[model samples]
Target: MIPTDWIYGLIGGVMIGAAAAMFLLINGRIMGASGLLGGIIDGTGKANMKERLAFIAGLIGVPAIVYFTIGAPATNVSNNMLVLLVAGLAVGVGTRMANGCTSGHGVCGISRFSVRGIAATLIYLLAGGVTMLVLRHGLGVI
Candidate 1:
């Protein structure tokens, strides 16, 4: 039998793809979460505040709904506040540097055969693998 984690991953992938497709089809724009949030923060998304808010709401609300409905699975991630804060800040900085996050460059961008997206995705994947290898195995920090 397939592992439960694989099943969960598949379901999550489908949901993400569906949501991205819907956002693109309905709004005629790529669904980059960072881009959306950045717009809101800088007042550039004033023209589509409702749309951005709805997208943000879904990002937060869906996970919450799932947690309330079926309980959350054990993530096995570090609970250290410092580690989490650093990781979050790193991700934010990385996303800004890359112009998008995994959902954008890795999913939507790659799906559309964008050169920048593909390049960014490859770089981020490589960096993540190297970081995990170093931090988790080499230094045992994570």
Candidate 2:
């Protein structure tokens, strides 16, 4: 039997792909969440503030609404606030350095057969795998 979590993941993936396709078709823009938010915060997306705000609103609002209505799923996140903060900062910096996040490179870039996206995705995956190996097995930090 298929697990309920797997079903939810498939549904979520389909929604993400559809949203990305629609954003590209409608706005002629790549729907990279980090780029969208970063542009706004950095004053680089002034020309499309309305659109960006609307997109961000939907991005945040939908999940919030869903959680309020249906309750949130459970997860085992680390209790260490320092670790969480450091991880968040690391992801932000890494995404900026990479010129895009997983949504941008992994989904949109790969769909368009972009070499940069493919390479960035491969590098991040390798890095993440190595990090997990070290943290979980070597240091037992996780």
Best by lDDT: 2
Query: lDDT values of the candidates?
Result: 0.90, 0.91
Model 2, 1-142: lDDT tens digits are 9999899999999999999999999899899988888889889899999999999999889989989999887668889998899899999888977889899999999999999999999999999999999999999887
Which candidate tops TM-score? 2
> Model 2, residue 35: what's the lDDT?
88
lDDT score of model 1?
A: 0.90
* Model 1: colliding residue pairs: none
| Clashing residue pairs for model 2 | none
lDDT of 1 by residue, 1-142 (tens): 9999899899989988998998889888788988888788778889999989988998899889999999987779888999999999998777877789988998999999999999999999999999999999999989
Minimal lDDT window, size 10, model 2: 71-80
| Candidate 1: stretches off by over 4 Å | none
Measured over all alpha carbons after superposition, the RMSD of each candidate to the real structure, in angstroms, is: 1.7, 1.3
